[model samples]
Target: MSFINFNFEPSLQEGLDAMGFDRPTPIQEMAIPVIMQGKDLIACAQTGTGKTAAFVLPILNKISKSGSNKLNTLILAPTRELAIQIDQQIQGFSYFLGVSSVPIYGGGDGIVWEQQKKALETGAEIVVATPGRLIALLAGGKMDLSTLEHLVLDEADRMMDMGFSDDILKIVNYLPQKRQTVLFSATMPPKIRQFSMKFLHNPEEISLSIGKTAEGVTQSMYSVYDGQKEELVRHILSQKAYESVIIFASTKDKVKALYKVLRKEFDIEAFHSDLEQLEREKIMSNFKNKAVKILIGTDIISRGIDVVGIELIINYDTPSDPEDYVHRVGRTARADKEGEAITFVNPKDQHKFVRIESLIGMEITRNPMPEGFERGPEYLGEKAKSSGFSSGGDGKSKNKKKKKPGNKPAGEKRNSESGFKPRADFKNAPPAHKQEAPKQEAKKTEPSDTPKSETPSKYGQRKNVIDS
Candidate 1:
């Protein structure tokens, strides 16, 4: 339906017009009216369905009409990436109105802390913050939200996953008990439903199907040995000279390790906890601006990043969580545009991939192993064996004749780092820099480890967000 049906204020309508936002998305259509009616809501919508605008629009409209800007609303997000994104959207959607917002997150320069404190001390209609940083501010008594009119929990499931439940409950305790509370998430696990009872007041529940991937995504998979991963990455990126690509790796160490190896061959950067806050922001800005073509990062960016026109997403590593697969793949094929998502599944992660397949309700096209590479596992589903860092495996290690016990003193425990063996080349990769590390986020001080960035879901069935 058209946005006009919402009867948004003239100023609000002007902002939507200036931004070319005409019709409402399904979630927006369902939620705007509930939020406008002052009813609490719990919405389940996946990434890339215009969920941001769903809550942002009505809140802005209501806050604008109220005319009093005394810390009217507080939005809690899981990451700094999402907090910034939501605040930016607030600015865009409230352009013609008097709504003001401040994003409270940590890890930036001291100047950022000062800016957040000042904005809250004076006046802001809305405040979007991460749990950790917001707690810091509240502990310091930096802002008074006793007059707060609304509270929103965006990416509710993610915040719960990232260990923010306690912090969220604490933050809520500071807000007025009578305020309108809204919750939005991509999934509704048992925990989410149980947690809502604590705060929601007869909240209206809206669930659009869960684990549903977008139609435009073209999804595919590859079963390769551990050593074959880097080679597969090169092959995929080379196949279509992708202008904008994201490689999802697991941890900060992995992100850095991958960046070092791929730097000379492509325009790439690493996004992880190691970089300075400004550097992270700069890298994200470059990606959105198309100056940086390839971004490799951990799940830190899995929920909130929203860069459209992303051409490719390579799950340099598969995610343990099936829902994350949806988020990573959702990055591509956004806004009804087509995109591709490719995943690399080693023997150890084959079962995880299988669960993802089940969650999405379809088997992904399995691309054959490249000509020179060794043949991979035989699609063994949950029976897939987890292998060590071996160069070649026919995926039948379980059938091999049991090897005689290794030479060792009787009853002597395996050395401290037993199963954690690494390739000789990457053995010293992580520790080499960690031992000599400078103290802080110097932007380059990093200890590289094994890689794992699995971009979030969107469609032609491939690509990335912290919230995209």
Candidate 2:
């Protein structure tokens, strides 16, 4: 329960004390021992569960215990932000222990590249890097991992999702086969398990709150039309007094648009893949420093960027994948702190939210739409589920293969099904062959039930008689 129980080195203990990390989270509690024992591990934990420290602390302790200061650990992250984040956490955990690390990622200047190259060549005890940049460095034949004793793939699922598995395998080719491999992921999908099988040799697996959001987060959703989403977001932001907020849009365009709308009204910033790495870092720094109250971004900031005390998370666009919903909300309620996550569900995305609720094992509270906006769509969770692709926008069945008029089933009446009956005269009309009479000049047929004084025009307008 307590970090002291691990009996880490005095320096590590002092660093933990300084960081106020006295208690080990569930993932850390379960994962640290397995990792310290020099066993391969596969840990399933959600974001904000102190997963960074789970592996970082144990690796630092092992390195210190071995009295080896050479490169001993290689941590691969999914994104540059996450790589930097892991390096920062490593620094905090190894503050008094004197463990050195350099974050290897792209988008930095030539000076930063030279610095990374120097660090890799001169050897840091631990090197945290993104797979792509690390592969590039490895190909250049300037870095060395032959002395590596530990290999960690943090956020392993994300790495695969971002298409880094090939690079990871290539990087693994450079490592020694005797080293310990530890994989930590928010969710363990089949792909992750399969990937882990190749690298981890009979690894110990641990799982916690799989496919679910944190308990401290109060989850709710608002049903709104696409046109009213911005108004709804503005309403939510204005209605509450949140200290820090993150708005997750699905696309960079959406993030830009929301940032444009909210920047004039509040202290806000936008983060997306389009922005330069420096700009993204600056925005994140401002957000973490409380200079920016609202941070709107795509899923890029959903997992890697961990800012504590985030009071609110707004899903400006509902994530189609349920796992993403978990990560977006996980941005808040971190470190056992209570937070709120509000999601805006449009009609097309309503089904996706339903899937998220199912995956998380709870029904999200449906908030009432604010006044002055059009009514939101009905909750189509069950209807759309039971009848897949059956209903169209107007709620009509899209049965393109309708039965022909003559192909009606036996005893099925046409009028009863179609709501209309053919004229009775057609029932007794002569057969086609007998009705083919001689052709003649066109003549107007008189209405059987109309008065003679009234005449119907070609357009069906009637003319009145003068005497009438």
Candidate 3:
């Protein structure tokens, strides 16, 4: 439906019109009405489903209507990348509305910390912060939240996974119990529901497309050994000149190694958890501007990145958690645009990939290993699925939300008993739609054009990149 139906304040409406946001996404359509009514809510939707705007739009509208304009809303995010991203969306959405926000995340030096502290102590109607640094600010018991009318827990499930449950609860203790609370997660595991119950008062619940990949994502995989993964990455990059690509591995070492190997032939950067905040931001700026064409990082970035026109996502290492596979693939095919995802599955990761397959209820087309490489594994198939692998990643146990039945596309089958299956021939999913890179002159990255890493707003904003 058109955004005009929401009847937002004129200033907010002006911002939406200027930004060219005329229609609402399904998630936004369902959640915005509930939020505008000033009700607490628990929303679960896949990444890139406009989850951020679902709440941000209503919150901005309410702020415009009330005109309090002072520490009215507090949003907690799992990572600095996300905090910055949410703050940016607020910036864009509130441009004409005159709503000011401060992003408080850690990893910044003294100057940044002081700047954030001043903003928190003085003004800014909305504060989007990471749990750790916010907790640090609250430790002095000087930061006040008694005036907070709204509390948002964006990417709620990711916070739980990062062991921020206690920190979040502590922060909640500082907020007004009478405030409206909104919790948004990509998944609704039991723990998240329990967490919600503790604070969100009789919240309105909305869940959509759980455990399903985006419709526009063309999914595929390559079976390879550890020794053969580098060559495979090279071959894939050579085969197609994807303008913007993200390669996800499990560790910083892997990201760095891949960057070293591919730098000369391709304009690429490695994004892990090791770079300083400025270094990270500079890399991200370059990547978004198309100064660098490739980004390599870990699971930390999957949900935080929201750049449009991303043509490919390559999993350099198999993500052990099935849901992670969903997030990684979600990186591409955003904004209802076609894109592709290719996973490199080594023999050791076969069972993990099997869990992924079962979760999505489809078989990904496994391309033959390039001409001369040895075949990776037997792909134990159903046997491996039953061979006692935990659905969570590694030794960590994630409380996976049971797959809810999602609406399948036309010509796709709905498996009522399990999850919805897109089609038996997902193996033959078509290549992503072609879009040439932005024609800007290439800007060279510093440090001899070598090792690195970096998120944004249209359905152009969400994500962070780092090196560890």
lDDT of 3 by residue, 1-468 (tens): 999999999988988998899999999999999999989999999999999999999999998888785688999999877887887788889877767777788776565566667666667788888899899999977588888999999999899999999999899999888999999999887999998898889899999988889999889997665666765676677666567889999998878777765664577777767766666777777888877788899997887787888899999898988988988998888889999999987656888888898888789988886643455545566676566434322312211122234634433322433232222322122113312344354233221211222123222221111110
**Per-model TM against the reference:** 0.83, 0.82, 0.82
* Cα-lDDT of candidate 1: 0.77
Report the lDDT of model 3 for residue 299: 90
- In model 1, state the lDDT of residue 279: 69
lDDT of 2 at 368: 74
Q: For candidate 2, write residues 1-468 as lDDT tens digits.
A: 899999998888988898788889999999999998999999999899999999999998987788787888999999888987887777677767666777788766565666667667665788888898888899999787789999999999888889999999999999999999999999999999998898889999999989989999998887766666765676577665566999999898878778766654566778877665666777788889987778888888988888999999999888978999898999999999999999987666767877898899998998876544456666777565654533333322222123445645633433435332333322223235524766454234211111122433221111111102
Q: Over the stretch 1-468, how does candidate 1's per-residue lDDT look in tens digits?
A: 899999999988988998898888788999999999999999998788889898888988887787775678899999888988998788788777756777778775555566667667666778889899899999998878889888999999999998999998899888888899999999899999999889999999999868877788899998776566765676566555567888999778878888876664566778988776666778889999987778899888778999889888889888999999989988887787888888988777887888898999998999987644456656666566453535344343331111234623423312222221122231113233543777463545332211122553222111111112
Give lDDT per model, in order: 0.77, 0.78, 0.77
